[model samples]
Target: MRNTFDFTPLFRSGIGFDRMLNALEAASRVETVDNWPPYDIAKKGEDDYRITMAVAGFSQDELDITQEHNMLMVSGQKPAEDNAEYLHHGIAERAFRRRFELADHVKVVNASLVNGLLTIDLKREIPEEMKPRRIEIGSVKAKPKAEAKQIEADNQAA
Candidate 1:
């Protein structure tokens, strides 16, 4: 059974949420998702993240990583073998394309393939203007009672 959700009301009432709604709609589509290459996402530091994928049969030449806007795509295609006689083929060599949605300001820093694991490092590079800054609340200075009385008396005498 497939679950379906309606975002028409949200679209009608909300503004500047099209991207979020589109992402949600895309996620709702089950056929577009593939689980061939298992992956793990881990947070290494405050703003650093790592995505590790198990690409057992894929080489560096066969894997392609691309980032467009806030979407990260990873795909692998094995070269066709002409003269391969296999009695029993168990390993999956099929082509696959996996996509990951990145948060705002998240960027792909580096990617490395080692020991059948493809690790992608990501860092959130929030602009200085966008980062939260401590705003110094200015203290309102008040005149002393004696000074205020003297000023008032002087104004009256003048």
Candidate 2:
């Protein structure tokens, strides 16, 4: 006997086929899928995040960070000097582009470059009404004096 798997049921489910089509479209639209610059994403706090990219040999003026729609784009370009002579060229100063997907409420906080690493911070502002709050319990109606006394005696015994 041979084991078999069925994919028809999965495709028939709601949005399953659309999800597959979207994945295919994304794969087809990738411009530089193989060119990946090293980066790190860290959680600064509950609603804050930081994205750090290793962008050595790139000046502050050569880097650009922009937010368009729901995408965060970071690109760097270093032009080669015409008069420079190199016996052996090992360093990579070529242009590169990096992108990140931003959530609906995510916003760029600040960006800075230190020691060859470019760090971009983001913060998601939660509305005051959306934040969790502690609710105060109001006092209950006055109980009968005899019933209250009986409850106190029961608590003392327990």
TM-scores for all predictions: 0.76, 0.61
Q: Candidate 1, residues 1-158: lDDT per residue as tens digits?
A: 88989999999999999889988998898765578899999999999999999999899999999999999999999998669799999998889999999988999999999999999999999999998999999998886666444333444653
Instruction: Pick the lDDT winner.
Output: 1
lDDT score for residue 105 of model 1: 93
Local accuracy of candidate 2 as per-residue lDDT tens digits, 56-107: 8888999999999668999998776778789999877878889887766699
Q: Model 1 segments beyond 4 Å from truth?
A: 134-158
The true-versus-predicted C-alpha distance at residue 72 of model 2, in Å, is: 0.4
- For residue 74, model 2's alpha carbon misses the true position, in angstroms, by 0.4
Scored by lDDT, model 1 comes in at 0.92
List the candidate 2 regions with Cα displacement exceeding 4 Å: 1-32, 128-158
